[model samples]
Target: MSTAAPKTPKLPVTVDKPTPYNFDLGLLLANDPNPVSVPRTTTASSDPSILESHLANVARDGAQVLINQLLTTCAITSTSSGVLLSLPHAQTPLPREKPVPAPKPETKWSAFAKRRGIKPKTREQRRNLQYDEATGEFGRKWGYQGANKAGQDDAIIEVKFNSKKEAERKEGTTVRGDKRREIREKVKRNERRMRKNQRHSEGRK
Candidate 1:
């Protein structure tokens, strides 16, 4: 037997209404209100005569305004009629100055050399001069000509001048050589690292 086809049900559609906006009507009415007169009255007490009280009130008002101005601009206050202002005064005591010691007179290099028993001709003698690197000492070499002719074999030379001052003269040459060697080694290491990185990167690519 043939079954009857089922009837299709129709779906109902719904329409939404726009929402209503809320507003205050009292604010609008207040905005349109008429201006009214306000009654004036004395802020002070009624014990004294009206004329004297009025004058006193005016004086009090003027004084209060002046005090307010002073308090705003400067650190000040008032009790009755007298004005009071606070000022910051330094309380640090002055440092006492002690008498300076007299400056020492300057001595000339030639006078200093002479005081150290260094003769001008002996001081100018450079042929016998030799530097001992092991002891960082400078003296006349044995069997050398000029100043070493005294026949003293191992006499310790007395250093009168500053060794550091003499060392500073040769410091520039020695330091430059060491720095140049260091920079060259650093550049070589950098080049080796760059070559190694280049090879690794080339393999990856």
Candidate 2:
């Protein structure tokens, strides 16, 4: 008597416009309507090598079914490169595995400006550059190593009796000393703001 050939399980490919496996197309996946009960046989489970081969063959067949179904369901479009397949969006959203990132803490100045609706100057709009004769090049007017931002640093600062009046300058303070003091005060203020911002960020965590 001839023995009957062992029957193989055939998985039904999801022919719907948007397959639940839409996001996993890279793996060439086929969707199973009954996810909890996949139609599988235990014929090769006793042999390790046979089981591995069985799984591989099953994957290959599933991939083929998915490819055939996608070809039939998707819209075909002609492009300069070649034919294109327009796949539909999956009705269900994929589950997120990770938590959303925390927002960065803002600086004191940034927070104040945001509340006041004051837009900061852009790179092109800021007027903080000038020609430094010593360097023979244009540089930032107020940053470190900037053009003689403090006229006091110049070899000969041409001072006019009606020249620019420096703020908080003593009655008898010279131009060079007044300029230096103003720069020092600004540096101290920046340091204080930095410390305050750091404390605020730490408190957020």
Best by lDDT: 2
- Which segments of candidate 1 are over 4 A away from where they belong? 1-48, 76-205
* Model 1 lDDT per residue over 1-205, tens place: 9999999875223212243222222121111122222223463343446556556644454444444434454566786978876544434444659876876433344446768986656555645667767668776664334243332333453444766745665634443244345556878998876666555545542
**C-alpha lDDT (0 to 100) for residue 63 of candidate 1:** 45
The estimated TM-scores of all candidates read: 0.16, 0.42
For candidate 1, list the clashing residue pairs, or say none.
Answer: none
lDDT of 2 by residue, 3-101 (tens): 999998775654333334433343444565423323355754555777677666556656666788678777889999999887776554567899888
Candidate 2 weakest lDDT stretch, 10 residues: 15-24
Cα lDDT for residue 30, candidate 1:
10
lDDT of 1 at 49: 65
